[model samples]
Target: MDYDVVIVGASIGGCTAAILYGRAGLRVALLEKHRNIGTAKRLCGHFLLGRAQAPLQRLGLWDDMVATGAGTGDLSIRTEYGWTDRSRVDAPPFLNVRRTTLDPILRGRAAASGVDLLLGRTVTGQLTEGRRVTGVRARLLDGTEETHTGRLVVGADGYRSKVASLAGVPERFTPNGRAFFYTYYRNVRHTLPTPAVVWWNDRDWVVLGPTDGGLTEVAVMPAKDTLPPDLTDHAAYIERYVASLPDAPDLTRAERAAKVVIAPDYPLIRRHPVPAPGLALIGDAALTADPTPAPGCTWALLSGQWLADATAPALLAGDDPAAALRRYRRAHRAIEREHAFMRGDAEAGPPSAVQRLLREAAVHDPEVSRRLALVGMQVAPTTSLLNPALAARALLVRHRSRRRSAGRAGHAPAV
Candidate 1:
C-alpha cells in the first residue's frame, strides 16, 4: 500500500483523524474536495459542547482552540416550563467558535503534524481487493485522475459521503418535521450566564451563541409550516421567532451580518456500523441525529478520535485491522444509543409524556436539570434520564407542584 491510511474529507473530523494517525507514526493521506483553506461551514450552530473536550484535549487542541479566541462558557436551555438551570452543572464549559476560524486551525495542525494534505481531490470510486476495500480512485482539480491505496480507507466526507456510497454502506433516513434557518448578527448581546442559550419546545428548537469575530449565530428549527415563504427577510423572521419564545434576547438593535442561509433538507441518517471490509466511516458519514440540536460537530470530533484509538495499534503491529474495526463498531454503537433517542424525538412530533415530565421537573430539580443539560450537551448517555433515583425525585417534585396549584385554585376569589 502507498499509505497506511487514506482519509476522505479534511473538515474537523478528518483533520482530527489525520492528526492522530500522524502522531502514531503512521503515513496518512488526507483528501479534501475544497481547495480553499479558509472555507467554513456557513449553516452551523458551531457550539462545541462539553462532550467535545476530551477529544480536543487528547488531540492537543484545547489551548490552541482557546487561543483562537473561541468563546468559552456553559450552556443554558429553556423549556416551555422554564429554564433548565445549569447552575448545578459541574462539567467543563463549552467552546463557541465559527467554522470559519476553527476549520483552518485543525487543517493547519494536521499539515504541521506531518499528514499528507491532498486538496482539490474528490473520491469517485473505491478500490477493492477480493472482498476488502483497499483504496480509492479520485479526480484531481487539474483534470487529472489518481489512485490512492491504503491499508485503511476512512470515509469522513460527511452526510452524503461518496466514499460510503461507493462502498455500498447501508443507511436509513427518518423525516424531520423542522425546517432550519441560520444567520449571523453584529452587536448581539450575549445571553446571561454564558455564550449561548437554547429554547426547546415541541414546535421549535432555537440555539443562539457568540462565535469568533464578535458576531453571533442564531440557528432556528421551527416546524416546517411555521416558516414564511420568503426567508430573505431575516429581520422579520427573527423578530417573529423572538415574539413567540419567552425571555428571548431582543435583536432589535443588532445588525444583520449577512443574508439568511437555509440549512439543506436533511433527515436523520444512520449508516451501518461497519460499512465494508478494511473501510471505516466516522462523523456524519456514519450517523447523524436530529440537526435541531446541532449534535454533529461534537460527534465528528469524538468519532475521529475513537477510530484512531481503536485502529492505530493494529496498523502499527501489522496485524489484521478487523478486530480493531469491531472495537470501533462497539464504540460507534454506544453513541448510536444516544442518536436513537434523538431520532425518535425528531419523528415523534412533540415531546411525549416522559419527555414533558422530565423537562417540567428539570425546572425545579437541580440534579434532574443537571443531568438533562448533560444529555443535551451530548456529554451524558440518554440512559441517564432513566436513573430510578433521579426519576423518583422529579416525580416527587411534580406531585408537590400539582398539589400547590390545586390548593391555590380552590382558594381563588370569586371571579
Candidate 2:
C-alpha cells in the first residue's frame, strides 16, 4: 500500500485523524478539494461547547484556542414563555471560535505531524478490489489524475461526501423544515449572562454567540416557507429579521463584518453506515444532526478521535484493521444514535409536549435547566431529562404552581 490511510477531507475530522495516524508512525495521505485548507466554512455556527474541550486538549490546542479569543461561558435559551439560564459547575466553559481561525490551526498541526497534505485535489472515484475499498483516484488542480493506493480509506469529506457515495454507504436523510442564514457583526454588545443565547419564537429561531476577533455570530433559522424570494439582498433581509425579534440587539449599531452565509438545500439530518471492509467514515460523512444545535464541530472532533483510537493499534501492529473499523462503527452508533433521534425529532417541528413541559419547568427549576442544557450541549444523554427522578420533580413543580394559581384565583377580587 502506498499509504496506510487515505483521508478524503482536510477539515477538522480528517486532519485530526491524519495527525493521530502520523503520530503513530503510519503513512497518511490527507486530501482537500479546496486550494486553501484553512478557508472558513460559510454555513458553520462554529460554536464548540464543553464536550469539544477534552478532544482539543488532547490535541494540545486548548490553550491556543483560548489565546485566539475563545472564552468560556454558559448557555441561555429563551422561548415564548420566558428565559432559562443554564451553567454547569462541573463542565468546562463553551469555546466560540470561527472556522477561519480554527481550521488552519488543525491543518497546521496535521502537517507538522508528518502527514502528506495534498491540497486542490479532487477524489474522482475509489479504488476497490472485490468487496473492499483500497484507495482513491484523484485529479490534481492541474487536471492530472493519479491513483493512490492505501490499506484503508476514510470519508470525512462532509454531508455530501463523494467517498461515501462511491463506496455505496447506505444513507438516510431527514428534512429540518427550515433554512438558516448567518453573518458576523462587529462591535455588538454582549448582553446575555451566557456567551450564547438562543431564542425561539413561533416558527423562527435565532442564535447569537461571540467568536474570535471581537465578532458576534448571529444565526437565524426560519421555516422554509417563510423565506423571502430576494435572498440576494442578504443584509437587508437579516437586518429586518433581527429588528423584528423582541429584545434582539440592534443591528444598526453594529457593522456587518462578513457576507451573509446560507445553508445549501440539504436535509438537516443524515445517517450512513459508518464502516465497511477497508473503508471507514467519520464526521458529517457518517452522520449529521441538526446544525441548529451547533453540534457539528464538536461531533467532528470527537468522531475523528474515536476512529483514530480504534484503528491506531491495529495499523501499528499489522493486525486486521477491519476488526478495529467494525468496533469504531459500533461505538459510533451507540454514542450517536439517541442524539440523532432527538435531533431528527427537533428538526421535524416545534418542541413536543414533554419537551415543552421540561422547558417550562426549567424556568423555575435550576436542576432541570442544567440537565436540559447539558443534553443540548451533548455532555449528557437525552435520557437524563427523562429519568424518573427528574420527571417527578418537574411534575411536582407543575402541580405546586397550579395549586398556587388556583388558590390565588379563589381569594382574588372579581375582575
For lDDT, the strongest prediction is: 1
Write down the lDDT that model 2 would get: 0.80
lDDT measured at residue 139 in model 1 versus the true structure, 0 to 100: 90
Candidate 2 at residue 197, lDDT? 80
Reference-based lDDT, each prediction: 0.83, 0.80
* Per-residue lDDT value at 236 in model 1: 76
Q: Model 2 segments beyond 4 Å from truth?
A: 85-90, 228-234, 244-246, 269-273, 346-348, 402-415
lDDT per residue for candidate 1 within 1-415, as digits (tens), equals: 3899999999978998899999999999999988887777666667787888888898888888888777777778789998876668776678888888888888988998899999899899888998799999889999898999999999999888899899888889988878777888888764455578888867688888777777787887888766677667765786678667887777777887977777646688889757788999998899876778777888889889889999999999988899999999998887898888887777637787778888888887788888888887787888989888888888888777666777788853321
TM-score of each: 0.94, 0.92
RMSD of each: 2.4, 2.8
Q: Give the true-structure RMSD of model 2.
A: 2.8
Error of 1 at 221 (Å): 0.9
lDDT of 2 at 270: 59
Name the top TM-score candidate.
Answer: 1
Predict model 1's lDDT versus the native.
0.83
lDDT tens digits, residue span 1-415, model 2: 3888899999988998998899889999999888886775666778887888899898889899989997457768776656763543344568888888988898999999999998888999999889888899999888988887788889989988899889777787777777778898998864666677878766677888888898888888887777877567767787888888766788879999999888745575455545568888888888776776777788888888989999989988877797888778777875576656645564546677777777777766778778877877778877777798998898776666556667888863322
Q: After superposition, how far is residue 312 of candidate 2 from its true place, in Å?
A: 0.5
lDDT of 1 at 358: 88
Error of 2 at 152 (Å): 1.5
